[model samples]
Target: MELKSWFYYLITHSVFNFRLLIDGLNEVPNNRDNLLDTIGLIAESFNKVKICCSSRRERLFEQILQHNPSLRLEDLNYEDIQKHCYRRLHTTRARRYAYLVTEELRNAVNNGDDEVVLKRRLGECPGEMHKLFTSLVERQDKFYAKDPKPYLRLIEVATKRGDNNNHGAGAFLTFFELLVASSAQEEFISRVPKSLDASLLASLDSQAPDLKANVVVRCANLAELVPNRSDLQSYPKEFAYKELVNADSLEVRFIHRRVQDFLTDSEEGAALLRSYNMTEQNAVIRLTIASVTRFLATPYMSRVGKSLKWESLIEAGFWAKNGTGALDIIFPTLQARKPLRMPPFTAEDTSINGKTPPFNVLCPQLSPLENVAFGFATGFAMVAYTEAKLRALDLQKWRLVVGFSSCLCVRAYGLGRESSGFLTMFEPYLSLTSLTQNLTLSYILEPFTDVDFWVFRHLSCVATPRPGFHQSRF
Candidate 1:
């Protein structure tokens, strides 16, 4: 059967085809003459069937429907828009706060069509989805205006993940890491808009010479800021929606798909997000650097392995290498006194401090002799050279090893002919023995395995450790 004839057949001859509704006809496009002609054919062919077509105001559709009864839905849908905002607010993480604001908007907008009041109310409670999204962005901007680091950090994250419309929304965890990354002084300094000026950067550097000191505090503050709430709950109150969706997953997402689309697809929304002098290219560059930092620092090594495929890591590295300026800054050489250990997976690990220690524990007994020797021999010099040649991975972790090894090497080499120095010289072999003991569990796994394999290879070549120096991994 002909395509139109088939459509007509289904509409006219089928048991459930008495009514045919064609909607959103105005979205078809500028060259809509054929669409109008087709609609006219369908309408003209209908006798027993009832046709109801809904569309936005368009000249061609209006000309076709000149004599037919039609209704303008923009006004009617305005009320629906109110209901939608109300529903979205109540259904969201900040329901209590949203309800209060939405109620105020409802009362203000509904009280006798005063134009000025209506305009103000619209700003607060948008009468359209796009406007509602815009209003939300404005609200966040106002809220974060005083300390825009977090908000600016958010734009950097979302833009880096690609537009939600094109690549879909990123997981909350992804945003959280990027947010923490944005706080890195090296990364931020490299991309801080010239408009912010060198003076501001210098001032920030004076306070936060090392990014780690303030990174945790900044992350905590940002956690409270986004999916933003006006006031925080005194006690922890988990949202119902978060519970229904896997709340354990740190996936940052837009509240609604349309909201996502608006931010991604609308020029107005992009402008709002990039209102800062920073460009999208610059924002993404900072985000990539931040991500590499966050990944190294996070306690989710196992999770990282599971979540990030080899391709994903490669792609992440590629973007970082190409972002903003070409290779503006490398990951800072980490200084360490102790090796960072994985937190024990057990029930007793309940206390925040107990669950997450400031420094990771290392088994020097598990390192290879050559790796230990090289690490103690050259310190950061060799590690820096190796890092310069390698791709983006956990250069930070290797730096920690090198830093500690260098420190121990100094003490060992300084001891001269002491027995302790001799013992320390054989420490890597002893560590090797311990590693072989776990051969059944993990075949000849070196302590360097804790660092990324690709990174481990780079660091292992220059490896040397004598003994006895505190080591800390991110």
Candidate 2:
């Protein structure tokens, strides 16, 4: 019926992605006419249950205020951001970041009294957030540029300018990963390669995403960024630009690698790589420049890894076909505990099949119900004329973001014993153990950008139907 901007689409055939709202309304007509179920599935993708909402933007801010009038709101003012970030950098080239031992951060890891400080201070630090914001801001010219300064601050700018459609949760969540990955452990940096220059370390974040890119991550045993103190040490140029990445110099990569460590076993990092490769039943083999953490970011990738060409699946299956399911399924597919099954779908009842849509046929006698008043609107308020008609239902604009924030509260508290008050307060608000288990997970999931609009209709189950509350696959 209509065609949207091709550039706006990853799947090229749906207007239902809340983020897609910024684009022209060209692609929605077809899906509206041919695939109502697909639209529904896209809407359901916002399900970040720990937040107890799909997180699509509906200006959730006002709505959240209505629910919790006392909820805190950080003013992302440029000056305030600068002040918070000032803590990150030195007044001069030679100033040092108080590299004070952040031990309580780790000590609180298992469940301890120091957990609250870790959650409140370390988790929401102004400096860390600013770095992310700066990276996002610079994205106009240099998103993920071959520099750490750009990466940290670019993400910050993106957050402060929260998207009215999907809110700014995805980028906001990325920060938690940094905190998790980059612990201020005193000893970890002892292993950092001294061959690289300290000044050049800030360039690593931009380098990490490239498939063939070569980068090293470590913490500096003795490193500090002083704005004007170029005299502290004479460093070599070869190691300065691309090789040395650490917390102060290359914050993003340092944080990212820590998260990378959390995802894959530390001991296995080296062994996982070979000129060729080795097979691990649980892990993907044949390591490449592109990390596994990068591959599963999109649904299309998951689908490709799951479904394959006819000849490939058949050709590989003739030997025994016993593990045929695993061979043809999504590569490094997210595992369940003992047995895994694709998400449930409704088995259709063909007896009632007809030209009429399923909802109308479900209750022919009640078909007249479409005329009843449901809200401030006239008749058919809830009666969607087409599946595409079922759209974002927002009583408030920022409600999705606020709802998502609520989920983060649960996760922050639930992950460790820290922030017990916040944890306990928000504990009742959400249970996103599934989503959290996969939180900030770049490759384990199919990236939202790759979802196929037409394929969405194939989903018969509710969004995020986690089978066992306690069991999860990495």
Candidate 3:
């Protein structure tokens, strides 16, 4: 039957023990307003039977419930929680060690009379979700005691896949995407076991297909525990990439949001993660950087790729700015010199000699100085990308410097090495001079030379300046 028919049926059967219960009403992704209005109408019209709805404490949900009387459900009390813990901890006599603390906790709670006394007896029973998750992991400690690497690797994939900063709804990855990223991530984590040594981490081969495949197999085997599937239907169809990922294996993320919070927020969770040495998670960030760079390097880009590139670039910039020395690690890797392609040349005239046709000339490779400049440009661009709004005034300075430097570099290359050396020394002082600060006057003097005009123009291309900045160019 149609939605209207269902509603009508429910409304007619109002007093016949009829009830409507909805969970996660606020989680409706698309047409949330329309859904809310419909629900509100049903709620207002139906007065006899019970109508109960549950939702996260998102602003919209709160706003909808503002005028209505509602009761906030607290976490399970001490005795109830102990019972739950005991159930999870219970096992056969051969595996009896698991129940030792659980039994003790149960007895302790049973002995107490008052709520306060029971709470004291339970003694830090991990009342919150984060603590609860931590307790669950600790319970499994005995099983993973001999080798925690696999377990730690699993947790990392599950937790790190979501937002660590507690912003937004967190990342939602499909099973396949998670599998690929996790495989790569696990390789990095296990490079040098039981250490966060930057040297070992830096030396790790992030490009190993064999290692990734191995990890993927390992993770797949342990799928019941780590990176477990989120509620697939909770997400909207548009939000989910069911077609791109396997239909049979369409998964969302980290069982629930509390699980994400437990991993992201708990001190014990943080320390546990630190023990595994998450410095290697840097590989993922570097990979993200490479993604952006590759897009930028492409000669032609589709509309989707262009939009994605912009997002990737912005994310890379954020990672560099606030990612706790991620930039430091990535910069050296990015700046590391690669062999530059030189123009093909021959030592002697091919027609005159019966000797081998083409002899390789001692062609110039990219100098250390050039590589350093490129690195600096890349780093500065990252900073500019993040601080475009917050530091709009400083961005003007950035534009001038980038544009002028671009011109100088071009001129030096176009002219000769001797000219490059001379300009290199004088460029810094010229930029610092008061004359270049007057952006409007500098444009007016464009007839004299294109140097200043070129600098202004180049900056505009690199970053779209704000309202006032655009006007300053004239």
Candidate 4:
């Protein structure tokens, strides 16, 4: 009764129009009578208040609201449904017409037709998505008639897929990463310098936007440059170097997922690949080479120190893992670079480390390529172990070894061992390895006995040093 009085007072006091919407009133379990009374009150105050509600056609509600303005959804919505269907039908026809215009315009430009002639040829014609894509590809081929390999290669990289339809090496490449990858390709390598110095890096950074635009044009609009959300600020400041900032904050992706799907469909994709004379393996290898080249060019101290950059390191490892025989090609190059020296350990150093030096101190510095390889191996191992744990599956022996190895690597890199505690970091993997393998502590200690040996044997095949280069101690 008090609720009814309050609602009555509210409706009476309402000076302007009041609109209320109640959905699924039939779903209300209790207070059916009170709700009906509220509706009656709203009807009495109809001049100032308006209420629209939806409910099942119950007998009680029908008797009360039958005389008032009422609508039967089942009967009254037909006109609305017809209007929606008509709009969709018109939209489909309009899209077909638009596609026809695009196709005709491309042909006209290729034939060097005048604007007047092109305008006349813009009449509606039948077309489909597959036909439109084919037309676009053909236009690109004609545009690059002299040397379409680079154009084709970029397309192949953009659409490359892995086993089980997973994203391949070229997928979701950032603007800078794609530029580096393109430079490493066979056709473009001679044209663009492979090595990037500080000045060159800045120059490329400045020109990144224009480079991206050229890339998109070369790919015939199938690929596009998208903003990199990770690099963007929630509320960006208005500042100078805005162009450079925008370039850094962009990534390359297909304009739409549908474009990727259409291009990567098994039958259509194979035909396209054969037409371009491109292979997924070759594209991945190029990406791997680019990654390694970039990593080698960047200084080690710059990579790990205050000016740290993980892009090259992470990319090198990822591409190398995916590219068959990539390590063989990059290992020599890595060794050719200047070797890292191991710092001398002294009693004072040991005393400062509390009888035992930290892992980073013991391992010292690794060659750029070795650091990438180790980081990749350890990171991959941790991911696999985590997935296995989540799925409640049997932990593999190799995973245990690699997981333990990763803990050591984490410590060696000074990532989080000190603050998080060594035992806390190592205990889970150590305990799991013991429980699952039923191995004695002696066997567990054996792998760490010769860190270099196990790391080379299990984690990577690039452990063999060049004739003149001494391999860094792990």
Candidate 5:
């Protein structure tokens, strides 16, 4: 569909349809370059938009601004906007595009494109296309005349943003910035006569209405802050959306790439998991073969393999240079480490220091306890990166890997030996094992697998930290 039609589709859709909303952005031209730009546009177009993202998405946005200079995408500062949401800002610009379908947009606007399809597609009200057209037709003169009705419409739309709690204010605030860029904000504010602004502010009787006054003025200021789009008409319809979509795509990929680390870690270090009965290292080989086979068989990550013919990539000697042998990502922990050996959690196991060392045991690949530790380690690294304000995915991902790997390597030197208290496991299973059924297993798994003692202690560490009483550091 054409971009305008897609806009209609977007504005008319529901929140749940957001994923499709993003996927549909590809219909625009120069999709990669303009994704963030279009995203900003979509945000402004809506009455209220709330946004959230995975950390990876935030870093993706950071990367785009740094590497792609001319695009000049703004860094959305989540810290400044925390007043709007309970969580960290992780949503990519894709989310903005997804959120533009506000109730007002969903209200009948007539572009006269596929009415039946529009209703079936929009799913909000019956004959939505006609209803939308009617609103635009009736309001065009008022809008062009700079009447207060437009401001009222904006206020009314803002009122309908039921989910004001979830950064609706913040995201819409960014959208206001988008409107500023689009010259829409200036138009919007200009339409609000001083009398209307005064009246609205005076009558800002409701909570949302009160927020509306502040948000509108801020939006107007933000709009005024943007550099003028000297040649908005020159902006290509097809290319605008494409540019915005592409910007978003880079961010999404940047995040999933982080996920790849854990998956690869699970597989490489996962001693027992077998895809189609392929064993350990050989299974990895087979996994690659099966990947190629599956790519040949169908199309999943088929882009890497390219073209339908299933040629053996192994023979291609990717690292040899026909294709790149270099890994897309590196896991420093995946090296040939000391053998997976752990001392049995015997009664003799006791700590040399009064306080047992965190861990000294050498655990097997992806042993449940080890997986739990790996989870903790990965999570800890992620938190550190956030605290450090590193926003690039590769930087965060690799940085975490480096830190976690270093921690692991040092522990591998002798981590599990210190504490047997952590290796303990659930006691109910002891009955199944006879010995374990009667009592909680002793000796934490530090060096030994299935030692019941240390497991719980390690878990306590992984559990969310107990909230401390607030005290002034000063």
Candidate 6:
């Protein structure tokens, strides 16, 4: 009562303007009801007194303050957030340009260029963000300038990866993966060490930071190394190669979304591509090859007889899904080998494994290369089939349907799988005349089973003839 009376006196008799602030009201543990009543009384009693409080939206507080003029923190700081982001981006870009200019100045001094000429070159450095990006893309450096294709390819891959909105979207290339990918080309392959060991691991660990720094420079500081969220250690134990290296847990990505935007913007993007003699298809092909090389190089079988073959296949599939004409190049290069065979699962195998193996019940006829190819085919088919179906649905055309379905059938046959189910699903749309006109399909499926041919003949007899059926192959 005395405390209440004191509060009433203070609220009623204060001559100057009074402002009261109670922060973290929800954190109060005792006498909250009385505190609320006091706050309500003070707010309602005097016109001169103003009260402001901060708390999370708890029901107790909401009951009293619901009708009052309240501002959310997000609303209050939205512009501030935008300003902070812009400031950081501007600062990073400014630093990069400064570095580039300094290097150019040093080169000019080495070459003994005239002062006026040097000044003119320095003046070429751009002031605006988009112009800066364009300048960076066009600029020549001593290190990467000789062979900018690899660096530009990396940028293209990163940009495309960002644009994808499907599964595994926004996943950046890990530093180790980037190193492998960047060095996978013929010119750079010799630089990769033949084997991974403790000594090599130490060397790689020491070189990783320098490599990351060099990558940023090569990319005109448009790319950055960020902490990788995926756990490398958790990979299957058969990946002894992983355990051999002290791989950095950092992934490569565009320094900013705006950098990606500048690279992907149609008009600007075309010029950028022309600057490096790069195409989107070529970038995907390079990544697919890189992934395959990495998978083959890493020994997936340990002395304990554990195999990471399935896991490796899945990893290769991830990259192969984006490939364009990759298989044609990849398959012919691989050496032919006998099919791999696995023994039947036993009680001991189940107990030792503690889980069902991924391919324990799989066919024994597929060689290691075939297994990898199957993985590639599976990924390719998933994306291709969806795209074809979407196109067919949008245009309401049977030609597109037959084209994609025929392609899928070829892939299934190549993987040694029956495509009867797939064919049956699109049976209604398959036309006899269209199917007969697809010579590529007929050639590819020439070795297919009698049952498949029978189905084709049956479809031809029952279905309406559709013209302009196109054929595609992997």
Report the number of the highest-lDDT candidate.
6
lDDT of 5 by residue, 16-41 (tens): 43322343332344564467665555
How does residue 236 of candidate 3 score in lDDT?
37
lDDT of 1 by residue, 1-474 (tens): 388778876776666646678888877756688877887777787666677888866566888787888787767799898788777776544564454346445544544555457566656574566665555555453434444454433543454454443222233434334443355546444543222334533443344334323432332212221342211222224322222112122334344445446655788666655555454545544544444333333333332221122112223233442332212222111112223333232344333335433222232433432232233222222222223323232434344443344333333333343323322433433343221121101111123332323222323433232222222232
Model 1 lDDT at residue 198: 43
Q: Which stretches of candidate 2 lie over 4 Å from their true place?
A: 1-82, 86-110, 115-255, 258-278, 285-320, 325-474
Q: For model 2, how does the per-residue alpha-carbon lDDT over 1-474 read when each residue is reduced to its tens digit?
A: 234234325343443433432222233434432333333344454432112122222233234323432322243376876677677654632122222224223323533434346667465423432233222223222322223221222222222222222212122212212321222212212212122223223334343344112111111111112222211232234433332222112222223323223223333222222211222211111111011111222222332221122112121213222222222222223331112222121234222222221111111111122211111011111111111111332323122222222233233233344323322332322332222222111111222221221111121111232332111111
Rank the models by lDDT, top first.
6, 4, 1, 3, 5, 2
Model 3 residue 346 lDDT? 34
Model 1 reaches what TM-score against the true structure?
Answer: 0.31
Writing each residue's lDDT as its tens digit, candidate 6 over 1-474 gives 998789778767767788988899988888988888888887887888899999876677888788999988978899998788678757776766555556656656666776568788778877766776676666647556655646655656645654554322234555665665555355323322232234543444455566665776677655666777743534445544442243436667765566766876846645555667755555554554444444334432221011111112223234333232333334323323222323333445532255422221122233344333433333333333333323434332344344434444544453244454444445545533434333223221123344334444554422232222211111
- Each model's lDDT: 0.41, 0.25, 0.40, 0.47, 0.28, 0.50
Give model 5's clash tally: 56
Worst 10 residues of 2 by lDDT: 371-380
Pick out the ten consecutive residues of candidate 1 with the lowest summed lDDT: 436-445
The better-scoring model by TM-score among 4 and 5 is 4
Give residue 130's error in model 1 in angstroms.
Answer: 0.7
Better-scoring candidate (TM-score), 3 or 5: 3
361, model 6: CA deviation in Å? Answer: 7.9
Q: What is the lDDT, from 0 to 100, of the residue 440 in candidate 1?
A: 9
**Per-candidate TM-score against the hidden true structure:** 0.31, 0.17, 0.30, 0.41, 0.15, 0.41
Candidate 3 C-alpha lDDT tens digits along 1-474 = 398778778678756755778898766777877777877877776666567888876667789777877766545376786787678756553123333335435544554544455556366555444444565556443434334333334335434534443211134333333333333444432431233344422222232333333432232222221332542323234423332223213443343445545555778656555554544334344333322322222222221122222222334334443232323333333334322222222334222233321111111222333333332332233333323322333544443444433443443343355334423433443455333343322111012135434544433432222232122232
What are the per-model numbers of colliding residue pairs? Answer: 31, 60, 0, 0, 56, 0
User: What lDDT does model 3 reach?
Assistant: 0.40
RMSD for each of the candidates = 20.2, 35.7, 21.9, 20.1, 29.2, 19.0
Q: What does the lDDT read for residue 66 in candidate 2?
A: 38
